[model samples]
Target: MNTTQLDYTDITEIRGPLMVVRGVDGVGWDEFCRIDTGDGQLRHGLVLEVDGDLAVIQVLEGTTDVVAEKVAIRFDGAPLRIPVGDGWLGRVCNGRGEPLDGGPPVYGREMSSVAGWPLNPVLREPPSQPVLTGVSVIDGLTTLVRGQKLPIFSVAGLPHLELATQIAAQATAGGEPFSVVFAGMGLTHADAAFVRDALDDRSAAGELALLINTAGDPVIERILTPRLALTIAEHLAFTQGRHVLVVAADMTSYCEAVREVSAARGEVPARHAYPGYLYSDLAGLYERCGRIRGRPGSVTILPLLTMPAGDITHPVPDLTGYITEGQIVLSPQVHARGVYPPVDPLSSLSRLMRRGAGPGRTRDDHLDVAAQLLGALARARQARELAELIGAGALGPVDQAYLHFEDRFGRDFVSQRPTEAHTLDQTLERAWQTLSSLPRRELTMIPDRLLDAYYRSDHG
Candidate 1:
């Protein structure tokens, strides 16, 4: 095969899907290639957007004049790959792992496929370890189990993107046995940039590998991007025993891609006009996160998907709620009211909370503090609604105190410093401070010792 003809045969358009060009003899799919255009300009491209035996090339510079007649693909004779050496600890890369932050190419090392395979069960370990994200609402309550697939359910226009960044920036497992693989799907360029910048600010550029499928990229690529990302993660986690966190954002878009492809193949529809196999498809991804039995490494997942019209019953979220551990639900109302994470505590839950929280994992008081605060706020919310009919002036002292408790919970404990990353201790201390506003007798859920120690700081 000629290395110089931009050589490929059977260049056919899938109409709206994308173009697939079959390499003449030994061209690689998703490998680096170039096309000589109308006026002798070399256009850099990647082999993809393909069918069986046909490799698709997307010209990052856009295809205008380059056609079958003059296009020549240089098959690097390998799959599109990136360097995963330790140098990745302090560097940035594009969705494809190309260094994007103006660093030199990750040089002179072996290359491997970004789309990796699952680990063998014999070498895997259970994800019984806790990975704290420094958010009280998360770490203290819904502790992130290392190697667990815990998804965040959100609606559009919520701060889910920003929230994901915070999780990426602050997440830490025991003994520092953790890394991150961030897979963004159907995100806008700006959204992608924000996450990148956030990671940069945290000095976490290298520890986290980003697989981005921007909104403008072909839909098929979005589907491929996460699978590729997880594949790479599985390699690092099980093979290397490095606990890896895989964060896939906008899984709704991922599902939509599934729907589109299914429709393209003319399949029957399920609830919410999604494909019928949505549940199993999601499980195929989510179920991959876990300790395999005895391997030192693990891969935890935080897959984000938006619910249409904020509907939890929507098939995407509904199926997700069932297959995975509990969820961190983002509420638009709370977000618009100026909460940073905008996590609706009442609605969110962590089913594996018991295993992940305790003295060693976190403070022993973490669980009780969470419970007391949640219960008090729930009561306060109830009291405030009652005051609407009975009048705040007529309500008893406990009821009024409940009202005050509700306000402080929303304003102080639930609200967060936009720039500051709060540790689990700080979050709990702040919760205690807010809870201190209540009378001692009302602290039913909390143990008496904590109540005496923490409840009295507010000497009224």
Candidate 2:
């Protein structure tokens, strides 16, 4: 807990959207502070940078028309804090978690700061639980393990929006007690409406809660949105004891917001013009999700980041990959070739995959079948490359078969949209259908029971 709070003293300058202040101690970076005009008006600012006795604050409300000498800042002795409670469900809130739907304020709830997350005790049970979104690729290959932090990395022009909506609409865990805390960072009005309408029409909006900050909103608001969303998730998982899935979309914009605040504070820049704290900044958010010991419910996070120009090497994605458990990457190049969801299997992976997939959980043959299918697909792709080099006219029958495998795998598997989300069983069934296209001798990797159960004709 923060001890010894400080009182406001003097403001040096009110630069556009920032302020310089003096006479404060223990005001750490990103700590929220309140400024009073000394005339019954109050505004909020975050400690942007600290230089000995001086601290730079970015006024979230903007520093306009407020004379320097009249300004007084009350150091909260901590970063911006929000109340987490079960009452927040089914309600809409601002970036700060204050109710925007004409609901009551978040008072009487245990106050927690936005930085550093609570980790579940290691001796606690491991997360073998699965939260199905009905999306084939996610459910079958990259299963979403409860308490894991999975990020979706995408480039512009992919169907990430559509996939996000489909997940919002259909995300479930065997119809068990569950809830959703969805936050949209820097979403356009259309995308915002798309999310709202998806939840509303499905009547899941009531079970679903939202914290939306549009692209036009202040950059600082983006920083606040996801925390508010996860606070709600934690409230449900730890307090109300309900399974919760928290989704934060377009974290690329969130990173931009971090840069904006960093720039306002005049901090040094990092790769691709991001702040130096980008890695720890993301870890602070991703670290929040988990299944606490003895808790009946768990909180899972699915944070989305858009890689600029499809470059995963971009600092935002690079740093994110380092912190997150795994990534679900979307490919625009594949989408252009007509693959819905457009996930690049080779590029994406789920680090917590084994915990959520297996017999009696997903299916007995899931791991082996998925691996073999992936291997076959890789071989087929190689064969297609060879055909391209040696001319298809001279290709052997086996190579010709591999070409067919490559073509159908792209069309039948990758081309399926999220709207047509398949259950794990359906996905595996489809996998077997495709596998039947290969010779029986090549099916050596599959169990005899599965080989008989699913290997069929008419794979395409």
Candidate 3:
């Protein structure tokens, strides 16, 4: 029952998505406001900045037909908040938390600020549990740990979206009550439909929530998509006590929207014309995930961002690497080779993998086997390069064997059907089968005990 209303009609300027109302007093930053367009249309906005008596407002619904003389503003004296409850699952919504599934409004006893509160670092428990994504490359190589922020770095025209959808559909956290909150920012209509259809089973099962902001939607709404999704995910994890995984696809679109707003705000641009506070802004979103001490639930994030022109050094991916735990780098070469996921293990890493994988967690030989696979792949890659220079006929027996091992690794281990979901044990066993094609001595990274138990030489 917040009845504090501060009304203003001094509409001085109307920028692209921002409105400037002068002669205003007692309006705080981030205060929610309502704007009436005099044509039975009411729009919502948030005060971005308060400079003396001038208040800069970002119209949530674009200021398409807002007449300056007739428009009236009513400030709510609070930040933007959305209703939070378990009823959000299995529902499709837009960036502004409006239901898109033609369902009734979400009923919640509590309202949560879309700009979530930060988790205290002292109260955070170290992430120790593995979040199995069912993709052999991710589960076997760079294992995703619960509560960790791992990003997928892809380029244009790659199957990153498909990989993300499959992971959302099949990811699990052992026996925990698992749920997924998927947010797609600046997606095309077809891509949005694809995401909905891909997670149809999970949504029907009441384990998935979707927030989609298509390209046709207002650019400002793109910035709110992930925030809305994360807010609901945080509520589900911290309040409902369920392990939540938030998968936000194409964060580049979100950043671009941020840049657009920055430009409109006349803010000073940093690298690549993005705002200077981009790193801290992304940190605010990514750092919200983790396991709180004495809490039974955790929130893990897999934020996907495409590298502009395949440049990992671009500000978006570069700044993301600084904020997130590690990255899963997708390979266009592997994608062209018809490999599903197309994850370049050499370029990808999970900093928390060592903590969540190994004895008693996945398998006793999990770490050893993963190391051996990487070692063999490195040698195979080198052999392929040498063969390109000297011709395959001139290669030695070991190098030629490594060349064959590379093919099997890509085709058998890395490649899988979209519907295929391999358990950790299945992924490890497949790793062993692919390793068997090479000489037993080449697996120096694995222990002799594991080798004797799982290795079978083709020579025998």
Candidate 4:
């Protein structure tokens, strides 16, 4: 392999955010490069493609005011690598890992590739531990598990960002050494500020590392932010032995960037005009989480993406549901009711919750209570529909009781302040309180032992 720096001045075609170099020798793909323009300004670039004697370069800061003949490009003979270690905590960096908080550039003794090292499938342990997100709708029903990739599926105009940031600011792993790596892609200025303000105390306490790529920034940076953030998280979780949760928001922007670049390169498009390798590309990021055998630490991921026009069958969410464990779906109808989290219980699910929330992990009665609550909610929905068809005054007592249960469940179990964080026990208590609105005989999913011990008829 060539390890020597090579400089080229061959004149070639220039395109949007891309430069084609002629007469290049031994230039490798993804290799870093420095671009010096005639006006004495230096820009960063990445090697996108290489044939025998020609290479395509992607300008990181874009190709404005860059003259093809006046620019000299130098290959650094290596792929993109960044300083990685404990020094990243409490720091805010841009997509390229450059400091944005007025602090000096983050440095450490070791540098790691942004493209992470793959984990061996044989060495992975099944996820069996709970990650408390402090939201009753999630913790009580769709419990997030360690070493899982559970995405939040939302549509535009919903408060998915608020729910994601709140979870990142408050999630914990039962008194263990925990940290959060939050990456925001193509965020507006106000959205970025909200993230900083929400996690300010956590950052100050050395528990957070934030990376932002704003709407005004280069689109190429949006493609790099999650990879860089995950590289940092893998360092903290695997090398240093700490539980790390990665929260990446607005992945829709990231996919758009991928589609934009694909169009630039003239690659054949797949569903929804995205690159054909979209599933593989997303797997490369989401599959980076999990626990390795004999290792005490874990990396859990909760990525948030908006569904275009609320279409669940869209390629993004559809492919994500195939790659991830399950999804936590946010609803506009529930948000209209003024619920803080607005998670639709009928739509949201955590496929690994059974393995993560049963006896010895969260509580012995956790599964039973979850079953009863969900069953009651399903019945409540039917009763409400029935009431709409037939006048409420004509309903039977049992249906009326179900309608009452629904109101209590939505208010007591689903609604909470944005800043509120509930413990697992508190969440279960609220579940029991909501169930008490139904008759004792109606709660048949819960075991007799737990019903006798925890059931209270006062709410009924």
Candidate 5:
């Protein structure tokens, strides 16, 4: 905790966004810096590494016309911090936490570190409450639980961004105090507009906070977007007692930025030229979520990243799967079939769904119905593959029944309009309708008593 601000004029080298300062004394890691470009222009930067008397500084605004001898660099001797409170709701900000919505600057009484404070593992409470995203496929099957970290895995050209925005706008905490903090990294201008327009109502209602770093913005800012979003979310949830959901989209961009910065630093690369600490770095962000024991509110994270070349084994998605609780996989095949969500049930999973759904939380039949639907969908997949090899006429009656069930399920249950929002009860009813097409004998996963109550023989 050095409090002295050091000013220096001797810069050793400049490359891309990184600049090396020589003859520096007592500079700390992550300390904020100010660069005066001699031409009366000022830019902000951060200390990335401090070695002996030399320090590596990353210019947040990039370095295009910086003159080493003429530039004046000042180390602030502290990490970056932002104002946090209720004032952030309904406001749009850039990656640096500056206002982008043309509103007044946030002048709250409290400030929090952008790097985030650490939570004790002993104090972490397991997630048990449900966070309902109004889409039937998610709410009825892989239910999102409070304080959970779930990633949405999608390939290029899939509408994962649209799905992320829809959930941010429509998710609810069962009439409890709730809010959503959305962070979009490396988004195009059009994509940023789509996110803002989709969440306009929520913003007006003071239940949303948007932080966007566009593709044209500084590449260094992309690394800060998620941290800024989570800092505000921690303030709103733990301090203000409101359940906060943090949605970070296009994390692939964020990782690329990391790889770029790593390359700039002359660091040795691991897989795909990403740093060796990729997993730990991702954990630093995703682990910021969940409920702390004795804390009134919770922070849940939903991150969306595109799998490069449709390869799930890519370093980004593969490492993400290891860190997050579960994933919601979007399918190109399903998307081509004209489904709005295109969620592949067999591919998606929620590890904490059981804790959030069931008799007391969502519905008594929720777990049972989800199980039955998955079983039927798996059989249907097998039946479709079999029919593809041998003509449809060669399939038996049971296989034909599965084929019909798959069609009805995709048409009736998995598909929903982007603007439409469904309640848990409505989602359950839709689940039943899709399941009804199957014979009563196929539903061995559900209890007989519960089946008699909700199953309609005529619906098939």
Candidate 6:
């Protein structure tokens, strides 16, 4: 359909970011459109739907001054496309991919659809390589793997943003050519500034790219933030053969934008007024990460979303948990205690931890040590509950030891300085030091050989 030759003046209704045109022909869904206001202003849009002679368009920029009688629409007959290339590295841009660093425009080597294709399951190589995040809790516990989609489930006021930035500054792809694409959705101006400052070193080093959408930006632009990021990442990982790590912060805001648009469209709402297709919509973004067989690079995702009112059952986090491989749950309780990451090991998991850790990948004893540490932490939690009811005086000797072990674990292992990046060996050594406080009899999860090699019985 050559929509350029056909202009429509039949905008029958203008409803909150949406405009409906009547007597339209050969219009297709998702085709780009340009809305020309009578007073020399233009707005870009996408055809949301087309039925018979009626077409619905979602205005990319909000419809602030659009008059139904004087508006004209021209369809481009194509979905939204973004120019992508290697030149995007070490650059900063807004959610829509416009330069925010006062730099020149990105001269793209190629242009690609923001709506990426799903990887065939048969072509996906099982994610196995460890992506060392330099955080002891993550590297030693919930190991992030190459091509894995792992999310950080957080609450308001927690330092998930700080943690995400720290990971971006320190994570590695086993000495491979690694890159990071950070997408900040609906962030405040101060938060956006914080991200730029925190990642300045990485950006200066040409290892990071930032895409930020502030709270004041249009809601529709927030919806496109992650898509633009993933499109660029796909180009980097597949075409350029660079292992790319995409960090998307506050996806809850993105979901809310989705819900807002859904409301404007008058679509039937599902859970919590979110559209029924919320699951598939989120999957479309997360499922884009993986290593294709015979390809030299992979795309690993770490999407951070805050659960509204600390409710995990909220549609956003709930659906995300189902799609991603696992989650790193940040604990308000631990955060209140002043832990840097506040990662609740009991609540957090990495499904690919086993495949990424152990032997040659990280350490031979990583799997065993992590299991023992978690088991000990569980006992410590139980002992703390008992002490709360019966007082520490009534606790048994083993219970007392477990309490001390827990204190050491949180202070030494779980808590780290924001800039302190630990290697796999340093992390493992700290794990062993924390576990050495427990009695040898309680260390059943660790093999005897490992105990003799790394564990110190005298410290127990």
TM-score of each: 0.81, 0.90, 0.98, 0.98, 0.98, 0.97
Off by over 4 Å in 1: 1-13, 18-91, 102-126, 203-205, 457-460
Model 5, span 34-152: residue lDDT tens: 99989999999989999999999999999988899899898887888889998999999999888999989877889887988556789999998899999999988899999999999
* lDDT (10s digit) by residue, model 3, range 1-460: 2255756888999999999999887888878889997889999998889898899999988999889998999988778988988888999989888889999887788998898866899999999889999999999999999999999999999989999999999999998899999999999999999999999999999999999899999888898899988899998998888999999998999999999999999999999999999998899999999999998889999999999999999999999999888999999899999888799999999999998999878999899988888988998899899999999999999999999999999988999998899999899989999999998888888889999999988868
* Steric collisions counted per model: 19, 0, 0, 0, 0, 0
Task: Point out where model 2 deviates above 4 Å.
Answer: 1-9, 25-31, 37-41, 48-53, 64-66, 75-79, 100-109, 116-125, 202-205
Each candidate: RMSD to true structure? Answer: 4.5, 2.9, 1.2, 1.2, 1.1, 1.3
Candidate 2 per-residue C-alpha lDDT over 1-460 given as tens digits, one digit per residue, 9 for 90 to 100: 2257656667776665788887777678878888887777888888877887788887776666777877878877778777766666677666767676677876745876665475745735577768898877787678898888888998887778778778867888777778888888999989888777766744334677778788877677788888778877877888788888888898899999888777766679988778888998888888788877777888888988888888889998888888888889887777888778788777778888888888777788888777777778788888878878999879887777777777777776555755676777888877776776777666667788877776775434
The reply for model 3, stretches above 4 Å from the true place, is 1-3
Q: Using lDDT as the measure, which candidate wins?
A: 5
| Candidate 4 lDDT tens digits, 272-341 | 8999999999999999999999988899999999999999999889989999998999999998988879
Higher-ranked by TM-score: 2 or 4: 4
lDDT of 6 by residue, 1-460 (tens): 6445578999889888889999988888877788899889988888888889999998988898888888988888788888887788999999888899999988786889897877889999999889999999999999999999999999999999999999999999889999999999999999999999999999999998899999998888899899999999999999889999999998999999999999999999999999999999999999999999999889999999999999999999999999999999999999988888899999999999998999989888999999999999999999999999999999998999999999999998999999999999999999988988888888999888988898886452
**Best of the two (2, 5) by TM-score:** 5
Against the reference, the lDDT scores of all candidates come to 0.73, 0.78, 0.91, 0.90, 0.92, 0.92
Residue 399 displacement (Å), model 3? 0.7
Worst 10 residues of 4 by lDDT: 1-10
Task: Give candidate 4 regions above 4 Å deviation.
Answer: none
Query: Residue 130, candidate 2: how far off, in angstroms?
Result: 1.6
Error of 3 at 270 (Å): 1.4
Q: List the residue pairs that clash in candidate 4.
A: none
